[model samples]
Target chain A: MVNTSGNVLVVDDDKLICNLLQDVLMRNNVSTMTALNGEEALSIINSSHSIDMVLTDVNMPGMTGLTLMQRIKGISPDLPVVVMTGFGTEQIAVKALLAGAYNFCRKPFDINEITTIVKKGLDLRRNSMREKEVIPFLKVQLHFEIPSDIGFVRSIVNHIQRECGRLGFPEDVFLMRVKLALDEALANAIKHGNKNDFSKAVGIKAEISTKKITIEITDQGSGFDISRVPDPLDPKNLLVEGGRGLLLMGLYMDSLEFNENGTKVKMTKNAQS
Target chain B: MEITTRENVEISIVALNGELDNESAELLRENVEQLINEGKVNIILNFENLSYSNSAGLRELIALYKLANSKGGDLKLCCLQAQIEDLFSFTNLKKIFSIYQDENEAIASF
Candidate 1:
């Protein structure tokens, strides 16, 4: 077997799941250690060789997955933790995401999908470690040029969420809000700015600093006149399905700005108060 | 997604026991459309087990509401978890749909 040199801790109550994941991860070139529950996982994490990441289950008998995540955060704050949950357990997934999970997968998950997520977590950790050596403060710039695809947009958001968690940002204040604003902005860029044209591209740029986080999204169409846009709050427009996205962006971010052409939008949110 | 539909005192209570996401929103749309086409439009979507939803799911809900209203029927929701309620509130969707605390209250409201 190839040695990927990435050590992963796999925590699950089910022996079958542990075995399945261990087999899958190992064949993919990564080594793994298995734990039955949160306590067991923490014990391994606290007193073992370096673990590059964690793969955990959300629902356990004694120490829950979320509690395990929190405890893992306490031990190794920057290590990415990927939570695994059963299908239809969306609530648990949401809680896990909010609790700073690097990512999550549904039960009976595909080997390829799990391996890809693990690899991404490993890459993020690698880049973070490198950045720590070079950058003095939290000055991170992530730029992507993607087609107007929802799946790509979601992946970008997930990565940024993990970055925010790693930076120790207040999860309650920023994680969900940032996700919402990004969704709205990206949707608008795709639907309105590019008119859903597959050939057109959307540019996403994110910057994080000690006191401010700024995100800029630019689309490839002629801009609209802000003054001509309907006021969604007006009684006549209350029931309209559209136009709420911009409002949501305005609400969630500390400041919102549009370029002179209005094709590019910028949103800035301040650090925790 | 697990969708359980049953009739309770002339009101159709549809229990959604999964995440409402882009993958499942189309299914939800189809299910509700089937109910509306059958004239079982006065509905209550029971969200006791629902945990998360994305923008695509929200779009489906808005379309479902519009369809129900145009058909001379109404759609109410019940047992929303805190995050789901906050989502509706955030979008001001609470103004369009009547939300109840439980199935009985939602049925009574209609």
Candidate 2:
């Protein structure tokens, strides 16, 4: 017996075909698991972590190959699947391929073609797993400079909020929380930092990645001590409206910081997913 | 923000139809002040049409709330958008304001 090269799950309603494919794959030094129907195939897939690829017959008694492939995708999105169809079922094989099967082959079986397709699928699976380990998720960065006037702040905040959506913030509630944080930071920059001076400008930078988002806002005015910002949640300060903005900023963001002079504020929020 | 006031006897229902940001907060404050000056102190701010608000707008609301209380009446809120309601929660003002699900409920509170 040859050492196993890869593990492939073969599914078909016909017992003869299942054994034949298993025999062929076994001869190719590939380990094979045979399931007589889609349900059995799913059972194997759920229980076995070693399934690298699926080789399924298009027309099955229970769930068709297309349905099984979709189910497999739901279970393991990147796991490669190959579909097999008998003669005159070319259309079903094509449909399976379109539905995200790695490849399809018509039967009465070409041994070489079957082995080649199976090998390729296993290679792709191995490569994909390796890629995932090394590849970093995409990051989005944005920067804007505008007059310290409050007029431009809203549009900039809106633009950043939209980018948050693109960065996969799944909830509107989370997006709003981000918006509120930005609003408070910008208002602090314009109103207190620049003292509402139209001649001054605010510098904004935002970085959005898969794991977290960071926003930095800088104004041309003197900065203040973050420790001095009153706790709005305090019972005595509950009715005091002035300090609530900073409190909101602190609460909404995972991290909030200010420069030594108090001109710049940075806020970050981790992705909730 | 466009604030449209409807007098329900001694109570005033003020509907805000735009964002209640910094500039618009002043507009809302002025409009609500007009209602207060006219002895319509029990105000129900209908935020059904209001889409967005920040700290500036919230400060204005706090001012309005205090003014109504000082005048021996109450300021209530109703139909706040999800984000605005969240703002109230984050600022710890949700507990201070009389929030209602709808205009009728706010009116009934008074």
Candidate 3:
């Protein structure tokens, strides 16, 4: 097995299971930290920097694994989380996978099986990180004149999705989140940032670092006050369908910032650590 | 993607062809939703021409099936290609939907 050289957070309420997993992981040269509940795990994650994987039990006393997954996604969207369940329900496994789990392992798992999965997860993370590093900087510039209508937004999203998928990203949550974030950001650039101006075009550039992915969208129309944008969670905007796009972008992206012009937005997501 | 719809007796058959990736999956969802909205409940998806489907397509199909079931109707599938059949098997969707060997059997069952 390949050594990831990073720590693993094993979260479970059961002390015995935690110790057993720790031992198993240690025997394979994997460093591990144990947390009895989600609260502790979150605290550990916040304090630490090099946690590469999280092996969590689905059912826990407080803050179940699924809830923990959501919180972790909010914090580190690229972190690989493997869920282990004793109940072994297909529906629960499927839901966990859909919610961004790397894989699900049933209780009473074979030691070899867990080891193999862990190796595979680590390899996947390494490969993806390498791909992010190798993503070439935007070289050629292409101008696209898109109407400020909804159809234009859909077409742009479709093209982006196809291009991203063709670039070798897996058809999974990572790609989905990128697609969702781009859709919302591009829509904002067109509708709110550019104010649906047909004369001006949006300039898009993608930059990839060894540890992060950044996308910039700039509109050529009049800008708006970034601080004036209303929060979607506010009760006043509950009935609106458009305000949620910004909220979704914030949730999915690691960092979002606006330039002085206020018509340009840059979104970044760090690759798995 | 190619979509062909046929109505026979009490069932509507929508045949899907080509790859059902993220781009084409939304169109499939809209097509099924439109049929359900038109009060055509008993529907069969003929997959003889479908070559590949990823998770997005599967999710759309599941959503449509649930919508049909909630409306006191059923969604059956027929003539699934080998690659598409493997997807159903891997996801265990074969157990969820009524699968038939051909369109005639599916329509007759409906």
Candidate 4:
């Protein structure tokens, strides 16, 4: 094991696995921080600046690995992410690789193999960051209005996911996160904003670039204050099933803010470098 | 996906094949839970013919492992394909489940 000054973020729902990985990486002299799930991982990434690489598991209780990857890319597109999977679902792995993962390894991995991959990913990140001329690309814009039909929201998200796949975006996490966020935002627009009106339209705009992707969803209905909504983690709401969607949006999106009208939300995701 | 169950003494072996995705994961979970509830604790998952599995399928497996462990019984895997093995390796799930080279070895362990 060779000592490297780079820091690593290991995100997984399983505590035992987190401990095992911490031991392995620490023994190799790599600094490590662990998060139990994607939401926590995002907070850690946002608050900490010294991280070199992110190693995350694909599946978790609330936010999936693909979703986490998107958030990470939004914050630091140049940072390298390595994904881990326990099931031989090639589609998901292919998705991850496409999303911007430097590399992926299966579970029950050999210690030597993981160490080598981690070292390589860190090296790539370091080299890329050192190059100062990497210009961010133009932001792509996509706008759609919420249809009067309630069932159409799912189709819209599915269509976006398919379109993202066709575009061959460098990271699959972006697609997944966008899809999830789109689903939540659209649902909120239709159900809450439009009050399930089949006639009202919700406007959507997406700005894409090499460095980040920002999307805004606007509803025709009256707007509400985002801050007034109680936190889902409140003690009395612990058993509730519905309040977590907003929390998820806040966690996954780099920034979730509302326009003055309160009917519009502008969310941004930084592109993976 | 297809599941074929065979019982020898008190040990049960569930042979699985085909793709296990969100659509098929529930069936697998229910079948495993039913067996566990029936007091068939020692189990072998014969993966000699399994082709693929997704995150949903992996969740089901984890649930089954937790159930079996709670009952002091173990769930063992046998004859995993290379790609499937890689998935296990990446997720570190291969650490949680006991794997064997063949069904005979897995069944005999109990």
Candidate 5:
């Protein structure tokens, strides 16, 4: 149940369609601002103080929805944009998803379905934002330069486990998800980032709370673009022998953040999980 | 990670404990290759004792699976912990490999 004062920008060329959705959204306790085209949508977005989300039609006359989506992402990378298209135009929906739209809904949408999607999208955005805040019970900082030695990962894991134990986290969790995610992150820093150069060191900053934990790993090497990291799940990459560590970290951890240069990475884990 | 092997008739049951990671993956690779070179090819990896595992270890499993098959042998795996099962569920390895609930079932398959 969305009981808000949250604003959604509805973009579609037809006035009647816009009113219908605005009515549907308002009846569900969501407020809306409508635009007849993508250009108008952009203008409204620029003027508004805050828009929680955008629900747009893919086939708008001027400045198509996909292009508008790209422009919105440029300004607000994490703003949820629901790409709506007619029933038969699923190809555009797929394209929109690939181009980083939050989600897609088909035209002739039901009020129930649209509201549910909107609520879920807002929840996801809020949860990710919450993960960024480190309300720490305790904080630990460490630095290490892993040499070209066997079982170096084990040594690092042991050190972290010691810190986790002192912080009152459970051993089972330390051995399970924590160990796996830390191993992958450290391996990336050592092998890929620093090329296992004994002279290079990785910096680590960790915040631990009774409920959650966040770890940041920074390396000395030149970083690559985070966007170009391929999806290991893609058909071509799935069967490859290695390169699945980062993907595994994503699965085992709550959220991941990387600096623009990708040399630094942050991972958060819910200790209670 | 520690790799120790025991023979149950024609099948070699390899027990893996501790973490299976980049460094340990090499040890498992060498251990399996040695068994294959000795013409003892049918193997069942008992993961009941795995404390940790990752993609590097996964890569070794894939390579050994392929190599064993090329020589008319098969690698059967069993006793997956909840975490390992979760991992397999994502990587398509769950569908690709022959997984059993227990060492008895895995060894019985041979």
Candidate 6:
């Protein structure tokens, strides 16, 4: 185990519990701060990136600990989070662990065991920091397959929105344009290519980084001739509903292309560009 | 999508809230269909609360406009969110739709 001095932010509604944990951690030479609720804890986490770990209770008034942890992960994903729960709420703690909490401890816990867990989590975070420093780029990739139903496309777009937000894409027109382009592409793949057949499926893959995002969408059906698509912008075709998707895709993406078969499309957008 | 409707004399003002995407296009279509079926032709679609939209939504809007126009009652739009306005401008639909900054202007033009 890497025996390094670490900082922990302890979040709980009870003042006495905060004081007790602060006292125990101070004696063990681990620096700590106390937050009365999840909101206060998030304020502290956002202002300082120096916090190595978070020890939070499951239930809080304003924002639940689970939500706070997810928000914290969005901001600094490598930071370790440890959840605490009372005896009856052990299930919540287990759910937290499954959702990426480093570990969970029940209430009225032994101080020694909690201290060891915090120390180990901090060490793992420190090691991750070292690895990130040596790495050239951090890429987040997501892949999804869905039936050829327009109803399911919204969830995929929402997933892309979250990933783009986590990757630091601005919450402005650019983000909306990216989402609109994806929605249009997915609709075309489902409605036109796959013919909305339940047996056919659409595949979507997105690779996001701090620099750029690349999205590829594929369908199971045979493709069409790109030249045959009417230009929606033409005065005669302005009222046409079907051709706008192709035009919008060409306008929104930094670069867009299709495979020779036209069954797949790849779009790239540069971050902050 | 949620549609909140109010009647301004003969004009029906329909305010749309939430996303106007592929999933919710049918809801808007059915709502507009009912409005047209009732012979309420002078309509102003208030887009101030619409958070998002896509081409599918755009298609429905075009179809709705045609339906309203065929009945000799025109469809006007007002209070479009910035991104939706951008979409209109990008597609040059701004020329086709009579858009106003507020409901009063859209109503006065009718």
What DockQ does each candidate score versus the true complex, computed on alpha carbons? 0.20, 0.55, 0.02, 0.02, 0.35, 0.68
**After TM-score superposition, what is the CA distance of residue A19 in candidate 2 from its true location, in Å?**
36
Positional deviation of B35 in candidate 4, in angstroms? 18
For residue A13, what is the lDDT in candidate 4?
A: 98
In terms of TM-score, which candidate is strongest? 6
Candidate with top lDDT is: 6
Better of 1 and 4 by TM-score: 1
Docking verdict class for candidate 4? incorrect
Model 6 residue B40 lDDT score: 95
lDDT, model 4, position A159: 61
Which docking class does model 1 fall in? incorrect
Q: Candidate 6, residues B8-48: lDDT per residue as tens digits?
A: 66999999999998878999999988999999988999999
True contacts kept of 4: 0.00
DockQ, candidate 6, comes to 0.68
Candidate 3 lDDT over residue span A149-253, tens digit each:
534655665565455444433345345356567767776777676777776677777654334557788887788776787774565543232355566667667
Quick one: ranking by TM-score, best first? 6, 1, 2, 5, 3, 4
- Clashing pairs for model 5 are none
TM-score against truth, every candidate: 0.63, 0.62, 0.42, 0.38, 0.60, 0.74
Backbone clash tally (model 1)? 0
> For candidate 6, lDDT tens digit of each residue in A60-115?
88899899899888988788999989889978988898888999988897987898
lDDT of each: 0.83, 0.85, 0.76, 0.77, 0.83, 0.88
lDDT of 4 at A91: 78
lDDT of 4 by residue, B39-92 (tens): 998889988888765444665787788789899998899999876785566455
* lDDT of each residue in A21-85, candidate 2, tens digit only: 99989988899999988999999999998999999988888798999999999998788999988
Candidate 2's C-alpha runs over 4 A off are A1-136, A167-174
* Candidate order (DockQ): 6, 2, 5, 1, 4, 3
Residue B27 in candidate 3, Cα distance off native in Å: 25
Candidate 2 CAPRI grade: medium
**For model 3, how does the per-residue alpha-carbon lDDT over B1-110 read when each residue is reduced to its tens digit?**
99989976678999998867556878998998898898898999999998766545666787888899888889999998775675566445666789999988988886
Q: Which 10-residue span in candidate 6 chain B carries the lowest summed lDDT? A: B1-10
DockQ of 5: 0.35
Candidate maximizing DockQ: 6
lDDT for position A203 in model 3: 75
